[model samples]
Target chain A: MTTQPVTLRRRRLHEIVSPLTIPLVTLLLFVLILLLAPASLPKLVTGIILPGLTLAALYFLIAAGLSLIFGLMDVLNFAHGSLFMVGAYIAWSCNVGLDPLYPNHWPVTIANSNARFVIGLLVGTLLGAGLGAVVEVLLIRPLYKRPIYQVLLTLGLVFVFDALVRSVPAWGSDSKAPIKPSLLAGSLEILGRRFPTYSLFLIVLGLTLAVAVALLLRRSRIGMTIRAGVQDSTMVEALGINVRRVFTGVFALGAGLAALGGAAAASFIGVYPEMGLEYQLFAFIVVVIGGLGSYSGAAIGALLIGLARTFSDHLVLELGLPTAIASASTVLVMAVVLLLKPGGVFGAKE
Target chain B: MPINGRRTFQIAQSGIGYVPEHRAIFRDLTVLENLTLAERKRGDLRRSGDLIFGLFPRLHERLQQQGGTLSGGEQQMLAIARALVPDNRLLLIDEPSEGLAPVIIEQMMAAIQQLSAYTTVLLVEQNFRMASAISQRYYIVDDGRTVHTGAMAALRDNKPLVQTYLGAA
Candidate 1:
């Protein structure tokens, strides 16, 4: 009897300890280093933590939309990242070129940072939605039963869009300009450390949008259909819900959100051709880590990746590790997470 | 069988409740969301509310819970409830007692019987006893084609036919 209790206790301990070991050990190591070698630590955390968080938030924004589309439609939208890039360009052109083209009717405020931000967001969303709808009608609608064909077609679209964007340099002359709003131009002191106000704004915006998304998914009727459609789309169709429209709406919503993220990031990172690729890779990692079709998991995964990248940068510099080696820490961490939980942190196992 | 145009519209307008042979609950959505989405209402929340909760009381109780977390019986009930929600004039329910306990099957039957008061149901049941109990009319689908169509009473009374066709004593 005593032996059985001891064995049971050991089994329970193993269950608790095995899953938590890596995070706990990593946390302890970080804390110990902070306590003992505070001076050796790099300024990257202080300098880049906020920006890293902002980037992660941007990733979450884009991925949330993509995840929703994948969950509901079971289609991998390879053109999603391309759609995001297009949004940034649209915003840039709308604020700069379009204003000049239609000067008499154009609002003078389009030149300003705040107005450009609003215009960019609107234009990006609409353009993305329109593009998605058109693509669905032309390409995706026909390939509903053929998933492999859908993926290949979308992948082909990415290259086509990339070429189109590269050819359209004349659309926006001020592509290099970083349009930070005047309200968020200044720095603020936090714990005797100065932080950019724009970073703070980005963080606030990302979190606010995340919360709004959660509420919408839980409360709204359309949101309910989206949630259901993710599981069994055929049943939704059979119920006389006009599932084709739902698919179009979901695809558009996802593409729009990606565009919004791209537009927002363009204000900070500047409009560059490869900007979407950088975010796409990170967002894909976040989605994998969070689990497929789980909103809460995505949020948690984003925060985790954000903090990990920040901390890893600090650790590498502080430890005098090779810059390239240190830079690959995020990938290493993601690999480890996958090895530990194959289905991801919150994903359901088949 | 050639379905007439009028029958097609009737099936389309009055929702077709399809309880999948496999797990079809949206793995991401809550029980209430599944039920609500199944309704497919334009803007009438009251109609959806009355139909969904009225059919399955358990769904009302576990509205916030994820559909994936429910028991087999509850999932079955949720599937049925989802079909019945949208003021569906006709309901098509797949096997309802496939993996349910005796008590749960009884409860399921009661719910289906109650549903018959408001909606015309076309139940595809493997359980001959259960099918005979609830159906006013019966259609035996063999090899994806209808082989028998008659009143439930006629089918029940013909013991030899039941034995030969349904493998039921």
Candidate 2:
């Protein structure tokens, strides 16, 4: 009887604390900034917060795909980084392809950067999905039961993809500037502070994608099969749905999202061969921090990383600390999160 | 044709449903999702759903509830309903009355009998009363080999055989 009361109290405590953690962190930060560095509050909101959210959106875009595939198939796709990198490059290529025809062949981008960006995003997503399908069939299918082999094989595939990208001489340098679509070129004044239009777009896209994917998984027939298959795939096959085909589709969707993220990131940071691997590492950290195989967890993890990175950078500049320590903040946050909850913030119990 | 259990699992591409003892319903998905996913084709969903609903009307009320959230009895019904959704010539239901209330067991037994009328049911139940109720033939196995094989009535009469293989049927 005593133990039961203690357990109930703990459950009630958890119920109150867990959901509050997300927004409360940011609110507390805002309050702290307002008190100590009153002048920096607006800057933090515009410069740090908005951009951080945009970056987190990009990370979520990539990690969502990663989380879904790993959650369902128990396959850790190390080549996902390569997919992200290629997606950025593909988006860049699409921009170049559309540049010459500006106002001549395809008059859509003549005065409207919206059409151009949309087309570029579509091309990148489609290419990424196609590549994902090819990889799943050729590389992943044979290695499903042998999970250890999957890690080694996919890690090797990452190297192969990196080499292939680097071999393409026309691909140019990693530092090449991304397209500056006319419509997405300017900034918006929010409360008398300027905010990047592209960042706003990224945030919208990320949220929309989250809602859309959630609905698709929860409501649609195929999406239901995929969710169920993630729990028990062989049983799904017995139910008359081809689990392999579902795997292929999910793999493609994840790759497409990663590619889309890359393309979105390309608008700001541009594309590079190694960028894929770097983002791949971030995706892993975020997914881990959030939870394995959990979409919402991945998103939460992304937001935390994004906010932590911004906060660390601001702290470094403000306090005149070494700049190198900025990168470590993400790791520090992750270490702390893992320490508190090994399964991640929203992960299932082991 | 010689039937090896391993080969049967491997070769049978279609027309066979195996509900393993684990109650292999998609725990993460909803009851409707589990049932709808089992359809061979998108056509005739209404007809099949109505039929399943007729058997287990409780499932119709809990359509949106997740499979894993359901009680053991509900899950069993979902498993059976899911198997019946697709056009299957034979259903291999393993241990239907393992851990359930006697009232629920009675309901499941009745459902199994009704299911057998439409599709051939190959039930693998341990409870002697459950096995004998509907089964025409019974196979008693011990030490991984068949010890007795005959009609259910004959097996009932053979008390020594029942005692040896099934520990008193």
Candidate 3:
């Protein structure tokens, strides 16, 4: 009996790399790089940390929804990024159309931004949710027991959604023109540097959402069901809960969150046809690094990626690295992280 | 096709409750939320309350705990509690004794007996002794199909039936 406790302790220790190891190594590497290359250090830290955080925040918002869907229903939503792009387009259109209605709308009031943001968020979420439901009911539902088929079907959906988005006109000149809100157009001073206020807002909004989601999942009944469903969906279904309804709800929620991220990003960055693909890659990286199905892990992963990107960009520029090499810094960091911890920071070992 | 004046397609549409065989507690939700979500306002609140808490006192004690953190026995109790919230006349409990200690199994049997007082129970249990102790009628299922049905006591008294049908003597 005493040996049992000892064995359990040893197993627990062996199951994971002590949580302190990654942070310590990351910190040590960061310090050594700073000491060895002082001139390039500032550039790397600033460049990678700032924009990376911004981008990471955006990715977090998008991936959080994907995480929920994957965790709960075991569905891979390839069209997730497309839904986000659609949200951005919707926000742009709403801003262009609704701006004239408000007085002094040129400056973009909290009220005006609120109205447009809400409209974009709601419409995008609803559309994304509706599309998700349709995808599940039409495609994924039939292949419930077959995991491979579900993946393939969703992959096909990504192409279908891409084509649909491309069919629309590009932002300004044609029907497809990606619109930007007039309010989010200005920049604010950050550490004596002018930074886009909208981008900052986007980052804050992402963090707020991440916190809300964490609370919801931890506290709410629906959230509990979602957690339980992730572990064993069949058990939840047998509890007389409409497991089908829960699946639909989860899909819609994830899609809507992705759309919110898309809409927020669209206000700062103009909408383009391939915008979703670009975001999809970033979101996938964040989800993987943060640990799929762990919201807190996603947030932490986003922050780390953001900071790393900022630092890498600066370092590359200072070192006079080739433009292509400089651009690849984010990818390099992600690769290292993956090599170090395959399950990601928060994921359980398989 | 109609069933008892309703559509025959809705044959299984009567007041029904289901207990999933696997452990699927909404990992993110509290015990109370799990119970409340399944509850219907149309039913008698007093009766629902009495039926639910009466069977599982642990649920009442840990109403605020997240479903995922509960022990196996507690999760089972919560699962059963959630099912009873809807006030279903016919309750379906799947493998309640699975993975439970003997003491917990005894407590589980007591809860089932208490629930059977108000609602008709269709318990799907592999444990013959537990089923026979708690149920008046029994059905033996093999490969997703029902193979035998009879009085619980008859199945218990008959040595051949116990051994052949349930792998028990």
Which candidate achieves the best lDDT against the true structure? Answer: 2
Q: Identify the leading candidate in terms of DockQ.
A: 2
Candidate closer to the true structure by TM-score (higher is better), 2 or 3: 2
> Where is model 2 chain A poorest over a 10-residue stretch in terms of lDDT?
A1-10
**Residue A14, candidate 3: alpha-carbon lDDT:** 40
Candidate 3 CAPRI-style tier: incorrect
* Candidate ranking (DockQ, best to worst): 2, 1, 3
User: Mind giving the per-residue lDDT tens digits that candidate 2 earns over B39-59?
Assistant: 776663566776788889999
For model 2, give the interface RMSD.
8.6
Clashing pairs in 2: none
Q: Mind giving the per-residue lDDT tens digits that candidate 1 earns over B14-99?
A: 55566666546664567866766665555433576676577677888998786767898888888877666666677777788888
Residue A61 accuracy (lDDT) in model 3: 81
User: Tens digits of per-residue lDDT for model 3 on A1-350?
Assistant: 00000000112344445533554565565566556546443344334455666887788888888777776666667778888877777776566555666443445434465567667667766776677677777777778778888878777777877777767553432334434445666777655566766677777888888878877776676776676666666555555456778888888778888888887777667677678878887777777777676666667667766665555555566677777765575576667777887766666554
Model 3 misplaced regions, further than 4 Å: A1-33, A36-48, A94-139, A143-146, A170-182, A219-221, A323-327, B1-13, B27-29, B40-51, B66-69, B140-148, B166-168
Candidates' C-alpha lDDT: 0.70, 0.78, 0.69
Please report how far candidate 2 places residue B34 from its true position, in Å: 1.8
- Candidate 3 lDDT (Cα, whole model)? 0.69
Off by over 4 Å in 2: A1-41, A101-116, B1-13, B43-45, B142-147
Supply the DockQ value of model 3.
0.23
